[model samples]
Target: MIYSEKVMDHFQNPRNVGKIEDADGVGEVGNAKCGDIMKIYLKVDDNGIITDVKFNTYGCASAIATSSMATELIKGKSVDDALQLSNKAVVEALDGLPPVKVHCSVLAEEAVRAAVADYYQRKGIEKEIPGCSGNCSCCHLHDEHCGGDEE
Candidate 1:
């Protein structure tokens, strides 16, 4: 599989490829099963602006490029704006991504959302987890409502 030149450039010379030791928030996503993992670090200013963003990823070239480009795109944006960034935008910014590798961009987007959510959580705000709203089954099941077993 040949990656686009844009993807190759970013992957070969990834920007913001390290961590922010004192990041305001950090997000980690994906797992062994998914064959990709991304860790994002963010530094937000008092005005809710993202003064800095960075990522460390273990995955394919597209995943690395997406993570790198996504951080670069959000570094100077407000947290809210950064959170609104979609995988499509990231893929488009990189020109385009192949179908099978599109999920890498999705992972990058999710990592960003996860980081912003972590920031809000730290600030005592509620987070809207995708597909798991309002006292999710996991929450109810683990909170003694199920009496430790379900018949």
Candidate 2:
């Protein structure tokens, strides 16, 4: 499967590849289908802004690229904004992804959301998952909320 130029660029030079020491929130998730894992670190301010974001992903190139892209998108953004970051947006930000690789973006999206969830939990606040469950648009069976576009 062919990847977009943006995907290759980010994968080759992944940003925020390390963890934040004493981070305010941390999230880790694994893709059961691929057996790949992603861990996200976040430093949030009192105002709920994500002052810093970083990720370490053990997966395919798309996983790394999507992780980098997700950090770039959420850094300096509010926790609510970060929660709204979608897998489709991740794929779009990377120009596009092969159908089979679409789930990598989903992993990235979930990682950020999980981090935000952790943040709220620390404050003794409960919040719901902001977006869809991320079934992935690439699969014909799950295209309803998955948004089968560009792919």
Q: What's the lDDT for all of these models?
A: 0.80, 0.80
Compute the lDDT for candidate 2. Answer: 0.80
Q: What are the per-residue Cα lDDT tens digits for candidate 1 across 20-137?
A: 9998878777653445788899999999999998899988899899999999889899888988888889999999998888878877887887788777777787766562232222
Q: Could you give candidate 2's per-residue lDDT for residues 37-150 as a string of tens digits?
A: 788999998898998888988888998999999999999999999999988999999999999888778778888878888887878886776653322212222234334343
What TM-score do all the candidates reach, one by one?
0.83, 0.83
Task: Find the 10 residues in a row with the least total lDDT in model 1.
Answer: 132-141
C-alpha lDDT of residue 44 in model 1: 94
Clashes by residue pair, model 1: none
Model 2 misplaced stretches (Cα beyond 4 Å)? 31-33, 131-151
Model 1 alpha-carbon drift over 4 Å, by segment: 127-151
